[model samples]
Target: MPNSPLHDWDLAPREAIALQKRLAGQVEREDRLDPVGRIAGVDIGFEQDGAITRAAVVVLAWPPGAEGEFEPTTLEIVEQVVHREPTRMPYVPGLLSFREVPAALAAFERLEVRPELVMVDGQGIAHPRRIGVASHLGLWLDLPTIGVAKSRLCGRHREPGPARGDWTPLVDGPDDEVIGAVLRSRVKVKPIFVSPGHRLTLPTALDWVIRCLGRTKLPEPTRLADRLASRRGR
Candidate 1:
């Protein structure tokens, strides 16, 4: 397991916002990722009446297949790990990492096979502060990561076409800066928000995410993680 203390997780809202501003600069929107083979998807779910935070990490070996033809049968699952800890922070709308990341770090600590890249189930730079959970965890783990959010947090974008490869730029309305991409991973299914977390560019993030797609709306790694996080609580 890899570990690095990037910052203190215990803080008030003001302090968390300040830390986000400082770390937002460290996020590299340009491509800095190595040749990826293993990819991990992470998700945090609450249990014990929202008092326990359960973080699940699912690692999958990237399959060699043609673009837009990702079949689940071809991919291999390398590892699946979960860690649980009592929730420390309240559910704040914008400061989600503060509430979710502590448990995620614990889950990462249990990982035996370090993934080359990680896919977090949250936003990256596509936030009001541009420091969502994906970016936050990436800075701590110092690994290439992507934000594979199921819904939009901030930014505006046209509805992507109902096709697997169709996408549109997710832009900040005020500055008109492109922050991420709204990608249609499965035909006629709701698109997922794809953003560069750390050590990755938006284009590369979308490419990898599209490659990881199977016969589901969410990618295989995050989808499996989501299932594990949900099912483990019961």
Candidate 2:
């Protein structure tokens, strides 16, 4: 796996969080490049021993429009990284990005195709620090990215209407500043958490995610990465 200029395994847990917070404050909330070209997704899983960590990255050439299905001609890459199996990080409400970012970065390094944008299966600026795994990764890579999470991490929301495409703003705090959105990507299915990861806005992230959705619950790139990562277990 490629080493990140920002990574430091020697740092204590508290120091890591502080480093992440410090880095979070420096990210520019502006889209520096267009992401209508290729896209990638990353995911990580563990081996039976739980001491070995496996990560997979899948990059697909995405054309424009709903008909522009993610081509199966993806560059599927995988790698195994050292894992110490530290006690699961405390469910610190808004800091999961810290727990998972390291593994995700390892997976990202195995990618053969550098995508224009990367959609991570985690959070983004929708967190308490305005930075999550997606944001952290994007900043590190200097690439546009978005977070498409399966579960809500932090933020409040009114249940979206019972229909596909229905959504409501995700309130960050008491002031209700919209941080993200609860989008019903599929009818009758639980909503997906859509947030701006880096170099993109919440609306742009949602638009791209919707464009990438197919006849499945998750986006194509993410779904592909999940399958590829799972296959390493066998």
Best by lDDT: 1
lDDT of 1 by residue, 88-200 (tens): 88988889999888888888889888888999999999989898999999998999989999999999999999878799999996779898999988887889999989888
> Which 10-residue window of candidate 2 scores lowest in summed lDDT?
79-88
What's the lDDT of the predicted structure labeled candidate 1? 0.86
After superposition, which runs of candidate 1 have C-alpha atoms over 4 Å from their true positions? Answer: 1-7, 64-68, 232-234
Give me the candidate number with maximum TM-score.
Answer: 1
Quote the positional error of residue 78 for candidate 2 in Å.
14
Off by over 4 Å in 2: 1-10, 64-93, 232-234
Report lDDT (Cα) of residue 14, candidate 2: 76
Model 2: per-residue lDDT, tens digit, 19-117? 778988876676666645678887655666455555666777767333644323333333222222332233355666555666666666655557888
RMSD versus native structure for model 1: 3.2
